[model samples]
Target chain A: MEIPVPRPSEPAKVFHHSCFAMNTRFSLVLVGLEAEQARALAQTAERHLLACERLMSRFDAVSPVSDLNRRAADEKVTPPDALWEILTLCQGYWRQTRGAFDITLWPLTRCWREHLQRAEEPTDETIQRTLLQTGFHRLYLDEAARTVRFQSKGMSIDLGGFGKGYALESVAVQLRAAGVERAFLSFGESSITVLGSHPHGPAWPVGVGNLFSPQDAVHTFQLRDASLSTSGTAPFNAAGGPRAFGQIIDPRSGRPIEGYRTMSVASPGGMEAEVLSTALLITPAEQRAELLSDFSAVSGVEIVYDSNAGEFVPRIEWKYGS
Target chain B: MDLDSPSLSSSGLESRADRREFLKRLAVLAGSSALIAELPWWSPLRVAPVAEAAADRVRLGLVGVGTRGNLHISHLLNTPGVEIAALCDDYDPHLQAGLARVKGAKGFSDFRRMLEMPDLDGVLIATPLHQHARMCLDAFSADKHVFCEKSLAYTIEECQAIADAHRGSKRVFQIGHQRMFSPAFLQALELVRNGAIGQITQIRAYWHRNGNWRNPVPDPSLERRLNWRLYREYSCGLMTELASHHMQVANWFLGAHPVACTGYGSINYWKDGREVYDNVNLIYRYANGTHAIYDSLISNKFYGMEVQVMGPKGTIEAEAGRLYAETPPPAPGIVQLINSLEHGFFDTVPIGGPSWVPDLKRDAKGTAITHEKSTDDGTAISLAAFANAIRLGVPIEGMMEQACRSGVSVLMGQAAMEQQREIAWPEGFRI
Candidate 1:
């Protein structure tokens, strides 16, 4: 069996430019703009992405997140207004998803990755110890001071799952504010936001592909002035080797969820789409609908892979809304 | 050895370690005072020397109070230990305007009277191209230093004459090629010298603007006087005014002037009875087989302006302050595995991770070469260099040569375009 590669869509009457930022490629496409104006707007959007990266990147030693990791354990630390707002939003999502989505899962992620590197599963005792280091409830937020403190040491936040959506949403807002009515912005291809309808169609057509075979679409979403985000698990390592582990760590189990699966969600808000996509992937098949009820106007689908003979077959395990 | 193409084979550095050692040696060689004296103003050691108390102040006279002259006036006013002693312009309004700006400065309708001021240590000639030769010669005759705006002279003979006269004079002679003082360009040059981009291969540059390339004149009778750039008798338009800056950078980086050049130009878009072409395209070939391709137009501002110095390993977009590696270095584990595989060993590669997803898909967008963002485009720094040189009483080492090479090369290109044939560097002309 041959895997197909996706080709670029037909060129539209849009000014499109791409740049590498925040550990992913970000693209901005503006409809009905001169080349000069489009370039200027793209520059503004790129600056906004860089600012987000500076504020949120865990790898950047000087980033605010890194500073919080270093200091929030012992004392209350007031974050920048932007970061404070994002944290508050994360807190709201955590409660809405009933603890399915958590930023404090970094400890569990680090533990699973280390054990997996040695081709061994983490011990139960190790998992329990690492679990002690995680849990959103251990985080304390002073509403009046806009400051946060960790109840336990090693409790950290990684924006890797949500930063792209936030940045894309920010760029989309800036473009709309600048009178760019029809636009499309995407971060790392996994998170995409559209400003308005397509130039020739009523909505922008976006595909949710099988994680292993990216060109094979499991589902498609028609986004009109909305955003879509996808979270998935893969069997192969980053270097293209056959590996048994995945990137999505189950916060409750303190281990990466084994199997091939992908979840895609769409909503008017970029943050809502990102949170639902990640949370639905971890929530039990029967509990996903209840978790998604907190977000209005959201649609989602879960594609689970079944090994038939020697080939992987993708099946729509569950879906919410059309 | 030709200064344009330094012989690299003699260094015998084949391995990366050896090449790094060779770069270290080159750095030491570049630091010597003897070499620094021959380097351009953009070199690392080209800092302003401490001024003597007695010779700290360098009073200057402005010859043309036009657009470029006014810009120089603004920079000079902010420059330390510099005073605007006289302003000269045949146009009464410009002279009055300059006089109004520089409180106590005297005004002159003719530059010769301005050059006659004993207190004027230097004269900055920002006049039209055709008048540059006469003003520079007169400035030299009056025993005053000269800072002439670029595309030095209208004719090749005039360029040679200016150089020849300056060679015998003790006064400093500088040109208005501000990229020489740009911090970004200097950093780019440092990268090139350190072999960050391997052997220099080619340079591609362009300047594009979507405008008619015209200056508004107060009256129709003063058209030639006000908008001299649009006329053949006074200027070569895009080639002299726009292309000269890129050509100067090309020659400065290549370390050699073009041996020959050929080009074609036309007044294609703005057919407003302008004597010079609105578009130009030229290719200059150096002695070492390196080529610099340049083009300019007034029809599209899409590309704006940039000088891309390319080599085998990477490209340095000097204007944009970015460098892109041809192939980015692989992750550390991948490098080790590749090396082990090449050596016929089967090893368990420790390359497992939470899928090493890149922050962005690596396309052609390269990394920024500069650490901090800057608003400077080198003009302010270039003016400071001029003031410092005058105060230190020493001419910049290669300022005149940079001017002559770019000035003569553009004139050659103009000659090539006008005569419909390839033009060689002027024979027997010495800088």
Candidate 2:
């Protein structure tokens, strides 16, 4: 979103403006309140103060080269403090999830991307090579110096799963600090974070759009001061595009997440919701409920599975309170 | 004019009449000055008395002990001047436990039956959310004081009825949203109201929890019917159970009722045939053109439990127990001008008939106060205040109607969530 260019002499009230961009496939909103509320939220996103959004900018720098790209020959290997903090957070999550949400699978992702670009499937040998290069335990993080290194040079890290949610969290915190008591940071159709509240309505009226029909919202969610993220194969696979080929890779078998079209989680923080959304989808149908209860951030969850009946069936939806 | 009578001889009659008049006038003057001398210069009307009664000796009774009701009894037993007089629960085990705590106190299943017992003076209601109305009505009918749990009642009609009952009885009635009595909350409220920070434009509140509903069934025959809170038949969900306290706080600070509301909820967890929401988020629009947002979930515990009040002058974070204000000291130029005057530089200047200058007031201090103890002391304080009001016959505002008004906003939030439309405040709504 373009930053609001304020004319100095204008009698400024709050200017509620939203910007749309394709990188994250969502919108950045600046709600110019009577004072500095919107500006504060914007700063939080820009500064990467939030764990979710902070990953996108710096993870790319630290990730191992998927292919030997000459452009990264003299690239700085060490990430900044902010990036290091995020990596540290991810490392802790890796231990917590036991590699369910591993970030060190960029090499496999790249290989799949190459195959998709060529409109062909990867050969067994190529798949085997990519699998060998990806393993959560293979990424070595140096705590003392705050650096990340791969056990094998081919190992890489990509933070695509959790980045947008973290960014929304950062913006929400900024909004709280800036005195904009409530707002919603909507990241395309994938996620939303309620900073404070709505101006004259309920928490926030969220439209849960139909997977088959993206234009129609089949259900609605009332949300406030919480982060809600949805992970689904439908967004990618709708047009059968290259990005859809094998995006949701299963850490267990190193293949696409099968039989799940959409999975959504409500959490107190964006990054927590993002990771859990992905993890819940890839979990076997039976163990999904038990696995979701492990995180305190998860308040409610809705998991949809692609049933053999040619329709997505709601496999599990659990809320915290009765 | 009666000169003919011997007693009315002009000079003698005049002297007699004057003598009588003098005595009567003397009495009148004496009475007037005496009345004037008896009046006090200032009465110093007492709002609350510190030394009126001992806290340990007051007898308390449980009128409708339920979930939060039991919690009240547990806390009250620990407080001074509070002793459980009788146990009044519709169910057996709850009543038994309460009676056990206050051995020998009377036990009655019906609240009115308990009220009729000569020993009871005050009643605490912790019944189903809907029962708050009828029980409070009975408590006030018996001329006993009341302390009803939060979200006071289930509907606006019930809220209004309770308010009328409280008003008609002229008895002390305190709602269970006890945070009102918490020192931190009180401090935060005062700071916001006093504009310590500035004009509060918005407020955010949340209470998130992760769990399933598995209360010990009161009766096997009742089954799901026994746990009324889990169903719409008895309770208001997260809004009533959790958001009520926070919403009341916000409403109190805003000094108004919500103008409108919009929200949504769903039954995603523990769908063991429960009607009340498992998750809810509500936003309220106040008459002052401000807003309050409340959210809660039953499945996750990553709780952001706080009330953030944002204002133009400063921000008061209730959870943090901190008040930040924009008290920039007088600018240096202003300071220098005052300094010059303090040194008698302004003595030669003509100014409003006298050379007057002000000091910097440099000792102004700002520090964040973290509450050392749990602010749950509100329950005790509220009880004490209610007792004091009953004993002293003092007027207490924000009775059941205030609770009802606050509750209506919660219901409105629910309505918004269900209907996906704005719920406007009814015209001439007192609460």
Candidate 3:
């Protein structure tokens, strides 16, 4: 219900545009440029984002990711150079996060979602069987050949959690290369990146909010030349019930983490911020600091919903940096 | 205006209520048959009185029992106070097939013999383009009403001759631009006339298909006769067959024929010794400085077909049955604040939102204009009108003009493409 209010008269230097792509809204706002020039650059950025969706979407039967899921179990398949690079980056993050971040958990996610839809929890045997098809250890990549192979059948990789961040980073690269000095990019409003300082401020002030009431900010972060990502309980559970369940699943337990909690992480790299946000959400609170030690110049915040009262209240549970 | 509840003021409410009342009365008038004759003589909604007796049945003969002819037969069969008296096709298989569908209908190989049936009240000329002019002239000479399937004739002069002959005669002449009777199109036209989308600036239309656009011929010697659409001598191919429907809509909506046109065409994909271009692109400039851009191809069906009538405020996609506003309405307080700020006024802007939500919902596709279900593209309704007009012996207003304008416009497009220059509207062609 945010009304489009008239702007105060100021220098007519900012250009903004939004387009739907990758199952989310991707927006770009650039400062200190003519409207036509900014629009041309935004068009280029949108094309890049659309291309990423074409390559990464698992729902599209003809996408490369779908082809990999269908064929990689029996033979090594060489991917396009860009996809190969992304796979390499994912592998590095999987190892760095100590298996906290995983793309091969689609089988477990599907099992839970289907059982939840049936109004039943997955049987223990079903969970164990699906777990066998997951785990980054079973996925092998040949560096020289730029090929990928999955050791187990029924294994699939879903980039839904990470594709947005990657696309934002890719667009940022394109915009910066085109001599765009100051710009803001947001993906689904959950992940945001800034190219330079704000026009009238030192940094772009972005607020981390209660997931249920997004308009009320619980905390604000000064984002400058960095990206911020948030991971939390979905607005509804898998069966579309209001009683929320966390979307972040613990890889070791093979079950969705039980809580109404959210984690926000800021890092210099878009991919790093996205991975660490989800990784930190499922990690033990005491061990969260140790997880952050592996990355540099990163800040983290964890907010847990206190439901003792009649209404849910978001309270900051932990903070890693000022 | 309160930001929380942004309802219209008293004066605004009064004006809106008055407008709604006016539109409601207009809709009632349009739906009532009693007021149809009082409508403008050129209005498509004008209706003739219905037949009241069994002897008032209009006996009709159909020429060219091809694809279009069969569709017309199906509709005519269901129409009240109508009889299919004769079916004619030079091709024995089509003639026999058409005769089989309509019981007790006499079959003839020559359309002239069918025209000689003195009892026939009308002749439905569904023949190929090259045969339309001759068949229509013959039917008119025999003093029979004519409902010729579209792209009126094969040549400009033939279209003029058909119109000229029908002008002095008491025959009820109608074209096959069924969209003229389409409920959706009528609703779209109503919206346009009411200034729902503002002054018309441009129209863009396209029709696409992925096929060879051919009919299976049992024998090679019947190639030209069977696949008549693929030969230049028989038809104008995609221009007459497909683009004409959209061109008729363009002319009808703009209320004027195009002043001039230029275009390019080529047989790029289906080059199987076909004489017509498989692809065509054309631009028609109107006298009002607006232009209609049109294109058609048989090699790609991705976009399918659509006729988008666009203005500054919004676009009415008549084919898709949707209207998309250029900009969604902003909140009232936001509008007021913007206006104040533009005028350099210091105002307390009342704006608030729940934190961390997406700022706006993206709507890439427009909303549907109406929810009423209609399975008509105007063919059924057009035939009913034709039958009613014939029975009442009343000529349909604007029917001949619609036929001439669209028939001449598409032929001009073909000429522009063939002669490699802009073709003006046919001179001295009165409709």
Candidate 4:
């Protein structure tokens, strides 16, 4: 019989703060501070996070990303300086991942999702048409004009999970510069970043646990000043075998990667972890190693859900060393 | 820590064995945008409790030293800027027991003498329901601030008298409806007020338990004192002891007292010659024609306890700290129509690839109003608020009215059940 799982002992004086931002809840854990001071620092971090969310949230009508998606098709839109840097960084990631990490595939994603919701496949004609509107190469960023323009009409860019990682990295930087030595921030339990080490250990032993049994650690990451992001497809039929409801669309195939699987990646930066987790999931098996080799101190794991077990059982299909 | 669960991801934040904080986080994350006003008394929660000097501490005297009183003592002992200066109980053993917990606290067999101590900043009355009114009036007459426990008083008149005494006083007069300070309740309140559940058309609340509500009495002579909750003279059975908490939440959300109430009661179980009924069911009608239905029994624990606020848009289980929408937001009228037909998500697409169709997932468990998963409830935070209010010398707004509305409402319930007729809310009450 399985014994009740125990949450590992926590260190003293860890103050927590939480707020709703980015259409999601953001939680912060700060250790070894007076409660009042921790609250102040967390509030500051929250402000920084909200600011980043305003810059990137595609759902926010007033957000710069939304403005870009609205006008960049016909006329050039000069993004804010900070956003321009983010766009350039995304372009870098797009090149590094060889288009696997493109953010311009939201139209294709919407198309696939609409068809999949009805348990039907979109026609090849429709996929080909959506393919025209996607691809990061089609979105031009002119360095001299500092303006962004889209090559096709009805094309849109969505930061999606990337926005959460960006917000986390931004807040983490603010905290580290503010002399915060130990902290934990999580957005929607998927994107996580930590500062310094755990109060009781040399590094924070953050574990990826079962969704139903949250304390049962399936895998543990002894992270020191690192971030982890998990990108996955939900099982289309949880009780049935091998069916997947696509979450992250593969920009190359113009369709989502087939199967119920997740890719978890850890890196020194939250944005890198976020980008690589999705990129690695879509990249072919042989190309994954070369894709990850470009980054320092990065590790990746693929957990493929075997639904034949009656209950969806996750098995590690692939692993890459940090 | 586990990165698997949203609730446990940062459970370390509330460092104490505080499931309350955990529940609050759950509610917030589950999308209960807690819209509680940033009241001043909660400053103690945000600010350091021990940082204030001893002179700035609010010295308090506790009158009752029984079950609830000892719970308060445990919280007050840990609360910052508060000192338990005196302990009082007519029962010498209870008084001694309380005194042992707080070193240097003066113990008195008579509560009146403890009220005379000029050093005490406030008095917390956690005595029997019958005694709340007298102690509150005396404490007020003595010019000490008062924090009285729930089910305010023995009768409607006494409830009025206590509120009247605290009316113009500069001192803080807080009624112990701790849900007022509960993070889960606060989150639930925000959802209700924001029209997340739309206009509340009805409310149904229930508290069910299988065991006989009794404390083991040391002797036959002490039965009334130790197990007073089961009696009519000293209490109104489950109504005042347990039902009042839910009543307070309902009244606060409804924003009005029940104009009339009717109920039925009977001593159907645990017939130990107890005067009060073992089971009771009541309906309170507010002026707006909406009704709050409540029921409790000491025979079935199946339903447990819950306060469900329902409207056309959704339903809120306040005690459970969850909100369920009739249709998940962004679901258009046609989607709702499809939902009513009970078609699965994978049903054939009836419309063309349209732009406005929502991506809907059929869900039933409802979103948790975070922090509701806490065993801490709001007792400790309410104690901190009490001490903070004493230090600031400001009364809690609507506290007396909350006390009277729920307090009198229950009394009305008791009367309706006992008298076998509808009982209207007391006319010309001064709360």
Candidate 5:
């Protein structure tokens, strides 16, 4: 039986903020009152002008074309301070994740995209070439000039996926400066950040959607000044439809992830939320506890695994209050 | 810690020993007379030199002095006539802490050493779920009175064996379903039994928690196997730990054992090394056609715990400390016909002997009874009764059976959750 969607009696008052570049699927929620502040943050995020944007944006994806196109075309140009900082930050995160979250993997993504499109299997040689030129170490970032040059000619970079969360966090800081105490900002499907508390009390209530069962909500989280992000095959992946590959790609294996039905992360910062949810998807089930233990920012996590009957049942794990 | 009964206070005694001797004699006379004869006749029996029969002061030996056992200690301290004699816990810190809570109590790491105190009158068992049956049986064999915590045993055989042993022993063996002693629950039970709510048809109970148990163990103390509720071997997961309490409530209200019960549970979250389930939902069918639905979760704290008993005439629901009754809707088609009959349908006949509105507007008699606090004073009341019976050498017929039956009630829910199948109690099975 399909139940009618329960909507609030009154219209929800809208809040605005923007940081990440806007596309059909990816855009920042602007929380500040002035549009110009939102636009400036968006520019900083798009050009990797701040290290917060680049360091925060760490994903192996094919979209967000500017960084990938320039690197692939061998365009060595000076960038802004924020962009340089982000690029340098990604290099560190790459090391910490043991090359599991390298951003310079667009060539490998391209190979998978081509093979997926043609319905053809790639040979070991094709996979090897892409892997060689796809590590964070392959890209030499010049901090003084804010210039990025690939040590190997074929290496490329992209930050379309992770940049939104990094940019969202940057925008949240801007919102805090603007004296916005309570707010929620979302960047497309995967990134969401909460500011302050709900007007009545502490903790903003966010509903956790069941990935397989669209009609049901598993649990609601009370978040205050926390960022929440969800990654799953529910949004974009399709076997024979308009969307063939989902947005999240596993850097370790150079493929879109499967197995986990959904993973939602809650943390103090948007970048942490974005990275943990993506990294959690790629990390095998057995090694997940060790992988998650190191990050102090990961406050809580809820994952739904598919059962024999294809039902998604949630498993919740949370750290004690900080 | 010092007080004389109102009856004894009028007559003066010089020293502590003199007062104790006089009080002991008075208690014995009062206890025997109260049981054998009515209050008028019993009062006179206590008029003579009341200084012969002395009730034993309970020297309580506590085992498993941790989170749960701590609460038991606090309650026992408040209880009159209980002297906490010894405390035992594997963790030295907990043992020291438990010893500090009850002044002058001896502390030991091993429970066996604590139980060896010859003066010990009773043993209070609040160990983890797995050790409950063995500890209680040991205490019983030692000729000590036992007060074991809920979910009395981990397995059906253990529950049955303990019940059998308790039947054979002359000592009092009580299971702690403290809510049974709660005034609100007692009132609710009374209201239902008296047909205030007609016949109860269903009961719904839930204890939903947001996060799974994740208390940090001390570094270098990775004894997850010992604190084994997190694993299947020791605990029956959410069913035994939580649902059993409500199941006992339902069983008591229905006044019959369930014919069959079935449920499902799983490790929905916190897929670490723990094998126990994080969530479970069960349905029990009573012999009298009543049904009880129970559920629990370790993922999110949204719905507070509550027990809603539905009857034909009304619904009695209690959560936390508040008891609310939603009376069934007013009889349908009353107002129109009463007005029509009062006015002769058209105001033509004026056939009114008395105004019908007054009868319809009569006020309800307010609440049946009001309780002032949440602490189960019933336990104190029950303990007083048990002490009276023990001192008088009379049978405590209904109390032990009630607790034993509820222990079985707890086991039924556990078995259903563990085996993933329906369980039925044998016909004519008592306690």
Candidate 6:
């Protein structure tokens, strides 16, 4: 391979801003724009972020998703077009992840949380009953009518993981259209998207920091015009004791994925990275290759905490692509 | 620290449960038995309620039967084995109003005369700023226990004098920083001590209220007496009247008083010829280089009040009673249990090199510090603590120090703002 000559970098000052939305913080670092212009761009992006929050947040009593959650179990509820498209995309990812990444497992999660808080585990009968309220397969999306209906009486959906990626993707689009070619956006530092390249390099070097020592980056990824999503699980805990299931429930078994592990994925789009990260975490190692083969130009890694050192030391156990 | 949401109704901690139940809840709020032992005020709550008898009762006299004084009257009235023996206020209407609320309690226009009342075990001083030192000193001289309302005194010299008077006395002396007894604040303190939020990085506290901080004056002649908090002569304005509560909390959580302070304040919005600032901003520097930033404004009520204890790992909004983790990692120790149950399959095996496995994030609201909505803001329990301490005839071990630290800290801030220069903690101040 021939080495190419590098282009000279701009003497740019980064303008930074952060706003809370989608239950996490969204931060922006804009290069080469004047302070005022960058502030305006950040404000515009924040507006877009909040708009996405209004569409997707289940906790909001009047959000479109909340409205659907209330009415869909009884009738075919026509969501706004934007929300419908989000649901449609969720359905696509649900199928692609082989029923692994589900938005309808909220009931099972609630069940486990309730049991954990009481220092008990759910009985088999209770798990089976709660499972009836879960599963993406139980949802019926009318493509023509732009409506959604639940096959069961208590099915609900949460876009907690997906909303960050989708909002970042939308905001990135807005920023690009507004002539922001070199920028970075992050949601809680777990979901990140970069535009063009680093101010001084060909690619932005983003890192997955050590969980215990967050300031120490354990893994670095060279990214350009890409999105990275890192997700992890230990257990569903309240006040640090009586742990029960993981925060991320396994849609198939109606149980949580076991152990302290984080899955990181880099993809060409924010939504893809977000979807694949959760999907890949739930998919078994024997099946991950099949899952990854479905997507192009994507990479991922799974990190497990090693505690034999008397402290948590993150070690990479599984990785695919580059 | 699993201070779980109680199934109790929101009528507030009025259900007088058993000692074991209270201790269990206190343990959860304070983290451990060792931690609970450090809080001397909590010991009083654990003591069994005394039988209702005049001989065994804690007879307390009240000074300044105004706004806060009336609140104290309510809490003290309900406190176990406590009798409001006397009430005093220079103002005639307040004296009459307070006298009407308590049966068999004598009324007096002078606090000095009230201090001479027979069988008055202690005196509760809710008087204006300038009177705290003299009232506390006179009450101490009368051999009475003292529970003085906060911003301990009008000036640093007075705070030192009050602390010096009460230092080694057998009589109980308590400062009315009620958050000391608040379940929500106790839970936050426990979490911070347990390193749930890692090292203390910074604390930012703010209090915002929409209306002008003023009271309707029945007569123009009594304006300064009624709204004493609005004048620099009587109070340090927002710094002493308002900021002291949060500043006390900051000092308690940080385990140190500020070594120096600087601030800026002005009568920005409400220019009603008030001698004090309508808005104040201050920064207090502790010995460890941690700075506590405090601000108060009466022009906006968007964020009513919050004492945000921030660190590298998380942030605890004490007033809102929520904890927000920085990265919110899942319970890592649970991994050991889960992996061990799996017979070390994935735990030991080297999965074929570099394949995909991933996870993501959840945006759940911050965890609640306490389930109970304490409508009294711990004032009731704090009053109970005062009564119990008097009954025990022992000074609260650290009460005088807490009073002096917060009292002097706010005075430093007030001086810093007024002089437009940094003010160091009062040198040679005794506690």
Docking class of 6: incorrect
lDDT of 5 by residue, B19-47 (tens): 34443444454555323321221232233
Prediction 3 TM-score vs. true? 0.64
> By summed lDDT, which 10 consecutive residues of candidate 4 chain B come out lowest?
B346-355
Better of 4 and 5 by TM-score: 4
Off by over 4 Å in 6: A1-322, B1-32, B331-365, B371-373
Off by over 4 Å in 1: A1-322, B1-38, B42-55, B335-351, B354-363
Cα-based lDDT for every prediction: 0.77, 0.59, 0.77, 0.76, 0.58, 0.78
Give the best candidate by lDDT.
6
Docking quality class, candidate 5: incorrect
Query: TM-score of chain B only, all predictions?
Result: 0.86, 0.75, 0.84, 0.84, 0.75, 0.89
Put down candidate 2 lDDT per residue, B1-431, tens digits, no spaces. 00001121222212323423432332343233322222111010112223315543556678655556555655555443456788787777767877776666789988778888775668877776777788888887888878777777888777777766666566667777666655576557656656676788889888777776546664677755456667777777777777877888787677678889888888888687778888887778887778888888878878657787887666677866766443323222223323332332321110100001112122222346444344343554455556556555544565554576678878888778888899998666554
Task: Give the alpha carbon lDDT tens digit for every residue of B51-131 in model 6.
Answer: 778778888898988877877776666666889999998899988999999999999988889888887899988888889
Question: How many steric clashes between backbone atoms does each model show?
Answer: 6, 27, 7, 11, 22, 7
Model 1, A1-322: lDDT tens digits are 1122232254334566666678766666676677799999999988888999999989888999999999999999999999999999999989988888889999888887777667667899999999999999999989998899999998999988688888888888888898887776666667778888755456665666555565456677777899888776544243333445557777788777667777888899898888888888888888887776667788887877787776778898888886
Instruction: Provide per-model DockQ scores.
Output: 0.03, 0.01, 0.05, 0.01, 0.01, 0.04
Error of 2 at B79 (Å): 3.1
Scored against the true structure, residue B288 in model 5 reaches a CA lDDT of 73
B248-308, model 1: which lDDT tens digit per residue?
A: 9999999999999999999998998899999999999999999999999989999988999
TM value for model 5: 0.46
Q: Candidate 1 has what TM-score? A: 0.55
Q: Which regions in candidate 5 have their CA more than 4 angstroms from the true location?
A: A1-322, B1-56, B320-369, B375-395, B426-430
Which pairs clash inside model 6? A231-B359, A231-B360, A263-B358, A281-B358, A319-B354, A319-B355, A320-B354
